[model samples]
Each structure stands twice: as C-alpha cells, then as structure tokens.
Target: MSSFRRHTCVAFTAAVLVIAHSAAPAMADDIPGKIAEASGILNDALDFSQPPVLPTIEAPRKTDIRASIDRGVAFLLADQNANGSWGSATRTKGLNIFAPVPGAHHAFRTATTSLCISALIELESGGLCQDVAAVAESIDKSEAWLTEHLPNLRRATSDAIYNVWGHGYSIQALVRMHGRHQADAAKQEQIVTLIKSQFDMLTRFESVDGGWGYYDFRYGGNQPTSSSISFVNGALLVAMAEARDIGVEPPKRVVDRAIAALRRQQKPDFSYLYGEYLQYQPMRGINRPGGSLGRTQCCNTALRYWGDLSITDNVAKNWLYRLYVRNGWLDIGRKRPIPHESWMQVAGYFYYFGHYYAALSMDQLPAADRAPYQSMLAKLMLDRQEADGSWWDYPLYDYHQPYGTGFALMTLKRCLPD
Candidate 1:
C-alpha cells in the first residue's frame, strides 16, 4: 500500500525528432524546419522537445493493421472488468519472488496499468478511431482506477518495482492533457503536487552516478544488469517531461545526472557499455571477485533504442551489431553477458521489443543500410504473432506491457511507415 504503486506507467515513448532548441517560430530551411521534418516520422503519442512535422512521406502499408488495431481496442474495452481491474488482473495469486515464474491471474498494477493506458493513448493519438477523442475518456477512467487503488498493492519503497513507474504514467497522462487540465489550476495543482512529491522521494534515492536500483535508489544493487536503470530512466524521463509541461520545473540536474549516469555505459570508441559493478562495495546482488558485469547488456540494449549517444556514431552502431552477432551484448564491440547471465531476460518488455531498440538505432542508417535488422524484425514479428492476431504474451510476458509494446509497435510503425 505504499505510494509508488499508485501511478500509471505511460507506454509507447519513442525516439527523437531532433530539432534545435528554438526561441521562436522559424522556417523549415531553418532549424525548426529540420525538427519539423523529423517529427513527422515520429508518432505523436507524446511530444518530444520538438513540435511541427513534415507534411508527407511514404509510410508503410500495414496489411490488415487497421482491422487488427480496431479489434484489439474493442476486445480490451469489452473485457474491462466492472471493478476497474483489467481481466481481474491484479498481483499474481501467490508470491514467488525468486525463480522464473508465470502469471496466474490476468492482473496489472503500477507498470502494467501504465502500459494499458499507453496502448489506449497511442490509438487515440494516432487517430485510429473515428471518435478518437474517446481515448481521453478511456484514459481518465483507467487513471482514476489506478490513482484510487494504488495504496492497496503498491511496493513500499524501492526504485525498481513501484514508485518511479507510478509517477511515470501518471505524469504522462496528465501531461498529455496538461493544457486542458490546467485550465482548472487548482485541480491541476493538487495532482501535480501529488506527482512531484513522489518523484522527489524517488530522486532522493539516486546513486552517485544519478542511476537508480530496484532495492535502493542510492547504489543498492539488486542485479548486475542495466534493466532497472534503463527502465526507470525511461519512466523518470517521461515524468520529468510531464512535470515541465505542467509548469512545474524538474531539476535540470535530474536529466543532467541521468545523462551522465547513462554515459557510464559508453566505451572510448563511443559505443556504450552497460551496468556498474564495484567489487568491494558489495551493493547489488552481483558478488564476484572481478564482478564481470558493467555497461554490457543494457548498453547494447539501449544502443538499439533511441538514446542520443548510441544513435550519433556509425562505429558505435557497427560495434553494437557486431557484438550482437558475436555473442549478445557488446561494449565497444566487446561481446559478453553478466556472470549469472542476468541480462538474458528483462520482464516488462516483450522479446521482440528488444529489437525495437535495434530498429531505432538503424534509423541512422539508410533504408538499404538498415535492411539486416529490418529483416530480422519482420521475421521476429512473424514468429511471435499469435493465432488471435493480438500479441499473445507481450504485456503479460513482462512487468509492464504498455511501455514495452508501445516501444516495439512504434518501431514497427516506423519501419512499416504507415
């Protein structure tokens, strides 16, 4: 019944529509124009720092996707339980904290709720439905349920499972409607105040490098992978963005420190590494003489995603793919995994979603140049497609499906271009 469990996790956050910071409206040949062009490629589920988009570009033709998305939305709405939980989705019936597990009941909370909200938000944002605005009302009901019931099942205090994710979606949903919501300043203030308080508490636990951990935000290492760090970072970034949009200023240091911490994964060649593991300090669960884990798994994973550091360098991109081929994770082209193979599976992200990072990274390449990963992605999608047309274990497979699927679908949307 702690606070972190209360908020929703915003799903489908995507990559940069890189535009220069502008003071005023400018032409397309101007800096704003470049950003305007890039923004068109990105889905507008949520706005990045830039606004304005290109008028037209050939997008991928989705085969039956219109119907697929429509069906998915209808099924979900029809299935929503009377009590507000999706599919009687709640915490699993029993606790098996350790050991690989499977979900018993179809239930969701914190991160799970965020993802549900994300899917609904994305469809609405995409204008997939004739009554696209109804997406807002759906989100409102879901958010109300999460906000009301979080105390019963939320994690107490830790970076990983609860609080940061709670703020992430809560803030994003509110931010999406910030302009409309803020017209009632008093209500907006109350909600913003609630979110900021949680973020403040979560931020306080940040370690020296501005990274967070599942158990302790300040250097409490639970595993030797970048899973929690990157996941939490995404959530925090979303939250930070929401805060800024709402007239509340998040500490610049938060993003600064976050970027710095992320940089820890980088190698000299500009390809990023993964986690941080100090031997004698004995923080996270990683306990080995040399602690053969740092900046490997998560670094490779993020490299495949939209992180600015990984996207800018060709050498880094090649090195990452090479590492991906040679073993799994690559840091400056070095191939390796944590001692425990800890990075093998991160919950909350669908398996195909991992490649979504690769697709985003491939955006830096020409269409011909990007063919390898693109082909790989198409195959992965084919392999994983459920008989039902809806993804079988996507959201259910991970700690939160909304964000993971959102990321993957956006990548698919990008590659397919429609």
Candidate 2:
C-alpha cells in the first residue's frame, strides 16, 4: 500500500481533563486589564518596529513562486465584486460542495474578501506586486465595505458561520493594513483602533475554553462543543498572533487560553484533534488513519506560526516533510464515494486548504529541514495555478479560486528566499 493508504486510524477514546487556569475564562470585567497585560507579553516576544512579514526562507524555485504570486494578484484584482465583497460562487448548487447552504454567500463573502485583501497586502509588502496603486485601490474599496459591515457582523447571530472566520480574516486584513499604512500617522491610528475593536468583538465570542469558535452559543444557549472547531481556532489564533505582532493587544488571558485550548488537543505525536470536546468521542472518521490528515496542516501551522516550537520542532515540521515528500496528503489509494462519511475521502475536499497550510507550516522550518520540501511544494503549486491566475480546491465554481489564489500567494511568499 502507498504510505498514505497504509496509515492507521486512531479515534478519540476518552475526555482528558484540561488543567484549570483561574484567569482562563473570558469575563468582561477583567478583559480590559487582560488586554493591557497582553501588551507586556507582546512587546517582550515580538518586534513591532515594522509590519509583520512572512519568513525570509530561501526556496530553490523562488522565481516560479514569485511568478505565481504575481499571477494570483492579477486574478484577485480582476475578480473583485462590484460591491467590493468577494462572494463564493452561489451559482454552483449541489449535494456536495453546495448543498443549498444557509448564509453561504454572507459568510464566505466577508471571509474571502478579507482573505484576498490580506493576500494583496502581503504581496505588496514583499514587493511582488508591480502596481501598488491598483492593489491599494482594490484594498480601499474592500476595506470600506468591511468597515461599514463590521458593526452588524460584530453582533451577528450565534449561528452565523461568519462569526470566527469573518472576524478572523477581518482582523488579518486590518492588521496588515495598519502596518502597510504606518507612514500616515492619522490613518495608522484609525486603522489600529478599528483593528482593536474587531479583536474585542472576537474576544466576546470565544468558546468558554478560550478558543474562538465559528459559531456563537450565547443566543440560544447552545453547547460550544458542537461549533468550537479546532481549525477555526487555528485560523483565529494565527490572526490574534498577527494582531499582537502589529501592536493590537488582545486580552492576554484570551490569547493564552486559546493557545492552551489548542495545546490541550495536541496528541503525543503532535497531531491535533478536530475539536477539543471531540477528544472524548469516537471522532468517527476525524481521527488518525482516517481524516486526521485533513486537519493536521491547518492546526499545526497555527501553532507553528503562533510560536509553538515544541510542536514545530518535534511534530509539525517533520510531519509536513513526510506528508509532502511522500505525497501522503494525496491519499492516492482511497478513492471512494460517500466522501463525507470517510475521513480519507473527505480530505479530497480540502486539498488546496491543506496544501496552503502545509506551505505555511513548511515555511517556518529551518533551511536544512525546509530544503527537501521546498522544491516539491513549489512544483505542486506552480503546476496547479490556473491560466487565469487563480486556484481552487473544488471546481464547483470560480468563487473558491480567489481565496485559493490568495492562499497560494501567501504560501509562495513564504517560499521566497532571502
């Protein structure tokens, strides 16, 4: 059997007790103080003299990677919606990728829009874009839409899919924008204030355990375990880290606990479970040898980017090497129907997402370790770039391409050498 198909399946067996931290809970009364406290830690751990930049790691295929980013930027510039929000292609309806989903456009629209904005900022910062003015104009329109909509989104219903993701990407875009526009003192202050407000909004919706979840439970008093997914936390955690890097201090306890919550899910081998509470259930197919691979890259990349060196040193780096070097993420032999029921099969749906995270994770490794996977990842991405300069996980519609392209560009930026 191929290495991918030969993996053993592991399931959640029991609930492991999470060590209690008195300050872990998010209480409004103490959150402001905690936000102040986070500043101390942020100042000590990160350098905020300049905007957050992707690692200056060297890749053998730097030329091709740069080309790919330029193409991606072009596609995003060409694909912006007239209203300035990038909506997922609502036209593609089906039982699989498009199962008549509720709030699909609303959630993905903001999330993807912010995602692309962040991408453009990254490209511009890295000097990959040939036309700064055009990208800036695109960002201005998108930022306008996001700013006008922030109030409603901040108070969006608990069930809204946009809660964590939309807020997470919004924070990313705003933080990057803050850094990009630092030369303008007034605009910088204004952008930073907006960034802080979004972080404050996200903090309110954090799961009881400290992780930001995609769904809010406050409305109907629903349980958090059903919606506080790990990958969503992963995305938000990285965003929080970026916010901290750019000088927007979130509540220390909230960031600390979210990291802790994610830490609690890390297995001995360093693979993270899909949900914290799911750690006690069968996990049906989300476990190892099943669908664990689907969540590995995103979860681990979050930890790695957020400075979890223990995982980076011991697990994520090595695992990514194995996954890409062996093409294990492809899971070549497990092609079967009813993909939703099988973890191995469902991984196919997240192919591009996983690869994107994989690229991010690999980018953090030391040169020696990153060398082997560098060329491999470059080829994987360059070969897949569509002629129009966008990429997608599924071909359901062109909607996914912008986000996919954004992710691809981010990955390629990390692949660039010093």
Cα RMSD for candidates in order: 13.8, 13.2
Q: What lDDT would candidate 2 get against the real structure? A: 0.63
- TM-score, every prediction: 0.56, 0.75
Q: Where is the poorest 10-residue window by lDDT in model 1?
A: 15-24
lDDT of 1 by residue, 1-418 (tens): 1111121332421211111112113333435436434422223322233322322222223554454455555545554445544533333323222211111221234545555565566566666643555556666777677657543333343333344455555565555544445468776676666566656655664555575534444433432122335434544654565477567776777666765665563444333322444323332322211111222323443433425644344433443233223222111111111113222211223233344445544565566555444444443344444443344332232332333344344445444432
Alpha carbon deviation, residue 222, candidate 1 (Å): 16
Question: Candidate 2 — worst ten consecutive residues by lDDT sum?
Answer: 14-23
Local accuracy by lDDT, each model: 0.42, 0.63
Error of 1 at 192 (Å): 3.5
Give per-residue CA lDDT, model 2, range 231-313, as digits (tens).
Answer: 77777877877888877887788777787887777665555676665677534445542355556777887887767766544
